[model samples]
Target: MSRSRIVIVGAGFAGYRAARTLSRRFRGAAEIVLINPNDYFLYLPLLPEVSAGVLEPRRVSVSLAGTLRGVRLVLGEVDGVDLAARKLSYVDPEGASGELRYDRLVLTVGSVNKLLPIPGVAEHAHGFRGMPEALYLRDHITRQIAMAAGGEDPAESDARCTFVVVGAGYTGTEVAAHGKLFTDSLARQHRRAGSGLRGDRLPRWMLLDIAPRVLPELDERLSRTAHRVLTKRGVEVRTGTSVKEATNEGVLLDDGEFVPTHSLIWCVGVRPDPLVEETGLPSDKGRLCVDEYLQVPGHPEVYACGDAAAVPDLTHPGKYTPMTGQHAVRQGKTVAQNVAASYGYGERRPYKHNDLGFTVDLGGLQAAANPFGVPLSGPLANAVMRAYHLAALPGNRVRVASDWLLDAVLPRQAVQLGLVRAWSVPLESSSPETAHAPAWSGHGYGPDGNAAEKPSQG
Candidate 1:
């Protein structure tokens, strides 16, 4: 008899952990297939470090095939799911399409950037969701500083130097905090070369959020610490504020204020991938609805977790778990165990995890973190943040550590790679294949357009 086949979608924090756990439990008893556009699992929390030039982009990506033994890795973006038929359709890297049948399907398809109806935001603002975006931001920041130094008009130079970041959540806060330091360092180098760039009056950075404080969802202590540090570093932190509109020149604030900036980094929160909408499954607040066991209701063979699934928060009674890597990692383990139990291996258990706490890296020797209920700040918090990331990442710890060591001891090497374009990394797409091309080519195309291929093997 053929081995029981289990397919997991979206090889992110949740799906990667699920595949790893199932591979260890089933060994060769079951065939585990992970379907995703990329062959690696990205450690998303450290993405800001990539954008800030503290860590290389590849440092945050762990190779799925290289790390997960006995698990089959399929490179594709799942576009369709036939629930009654128990099959999934996907498009591969080389632009081919195919399908796969599974005994159990895990819909871990993660979230994408959540965009508002703000004018020109979808067209202008680049998001910081994936590796490519990080790379693009790194290059863009370096280029902006370079261009500011060379430009003749002082007003144009100031505009090029100014960076406007929308959203002051963890991602935005981290980006703005680290981004200021990076641009300052770049300005220093330009001034040394007699490039007419002044060291004292360097580029300006503004962080905007609709909440009352930076990292509003985090502990109050962390928010206060982060806000203080950013203020000292000269970051303009505007609370209870948001972008009303975005244009080629800059962003318009809700308070009827317009800021001129060549760089507008959008770190707004994420929503479940649009693919979830195509599933025709029951949803709660734009997320696929799943039971405490991480199984889709009315379909025991179907499981969902991560940012895509609205898993019940038993601890909160009526609330759903927040979209964080911490929760997704734990939920992935639970889903794997439940799937094994369905195969008669063991009894299944519901997923329940208490908040371990949150960490916000403020770049350099500053950070705001609450680990296991302990409020930490300054260098100590930065140490804790670095240690947590090293422990959480699945692979390449040595390389990441080495990069940190170099960044601490040596100056940052600032140069634009210019590989990723603003058009490539939009404010919405997460998966690489779709992010590689324009949004219209991947989703909006009809049958007349060439369809992307499916690269799944069994």
Candidate 2:
């Protein structure tokens, strides 16, 4: 009999782990293929640090080929899958199309940004998902502050200096916190240079969420810690409020107040990749539905995990697992084992993992973390948070750690690398290039493409 071919689509938490585990379990027995746009797996949790100049972009990306030894790496985005034929079609970086025949398939394409119906949000609000968005934001923030420093019109200066971040999740909170400090440092530099810019008034940031508190999904204690830290850092936290509309000038809140600002960041949440809809599989809330064993309900040859799948939470009856990296990574391991079982290597088992805890980096020495449900805050939380990320990252730990060390010893290098355009990293795109594209696209380009829903990344 021919050797079984296994294809995993994605290089995020779940897909990467699946590839790693399967390669080890099967060794030379089975052929494994991993498909993704980038050559590396992104350590998404530390993306805010990248934007804040606390770390380099390379620190967050682990080389796929260098790390996954036994798996064949396919550098492209899977466009369509013929389940009956067991064939996967994807377009390469150079626009060439290729097909792969598989005995087993794993769908872990992950999630995309969730865009609300708010006006102008699609045009003006930016997201922080991948490195491209992070780099673009870093440049955009610096540009805004520099423009505000020397602008002749007071109103224009205020608008340029004002920033609004919607949502108070871990990503939103960290972005706002780190972003606040970055802007301040930029403004101070302009004043020191005597750039004829008003340095008396500092940049203003507002963090908004419809929920009553920040980190609504996290423990109440962690939320309170984050709230206190943000409030102390001069971030305007508006709970129970949301944007009714967003214009280039600013956003109109549900509370009948219009907040004027040139920057509006949308960190609302994420929905499963739209590609899941094309799979012809049963789905729940846009996520592919899977049995407890991480297999498609009717197709034992197919598996789905990560943000793309709706997996049952055995720990909480009547609930599906929340879309998070923690669960996705574990599910990847379980799916690999189950796939091996289909080849008569082992027995398949259900996917079940309890929440360990969460870490929220609030920039500087401030952080909110709960490891093993033990709440911690301040520098202690910061230490734990860094440790958690260093331990969780599959690769590039040394580089990331070095960056952190240098950040402590040296001043932040805040020069903008004008690479990512506003269109390239739109609110959402089904195209895979958007997911793996570079941060900078030549000169004078930004990621201002069509809009889609927001994404929730771990």
lDDT of each: 0.87, 0.86
Candidate 1 displacement at residue 343 in angstroms: 0.2
Worst 10 residues of 1 by lDDT: 449-458
- lDDT per residue, candidate 1, 1-458, as tens digits? 36989999999889999999999999999999999989889998888888888898789889998999999988898889999999999989899998999999999988888888888887778887888888888988998889889888888788789999889998999999999999999999998888866546978999999898888788889999999999999999999999888777777899999888878888878888888888888998789999999999999999999999999999999999999999999999999999999998889999999998888989998988888999999999989998999999889999999999999999989988777766667675656324565445554433433224421000
lDDT of residue 325 for candidate 2:
90
- CA shift at 173, candidate 2, in angstroms? 0.9
Off by over 4 Å in 2: 431-458
Instruction: Put down candidate 2 lDDT per residue, 401-440, tens digits, no spaces.
Output: 8988888888777576656656556665564225444334
Show model 1 residue runs off by greater than 4 Å: 430-434, 438-458
TM-score, per-candidate, Cα-based: 0.94, 0.94
Best by TM-score: 1
Query: Positional deviation of 135 in candidate 1, in angstroms?
Result: 0.8
Highest lDDT: give the candidate number. Answer: 1
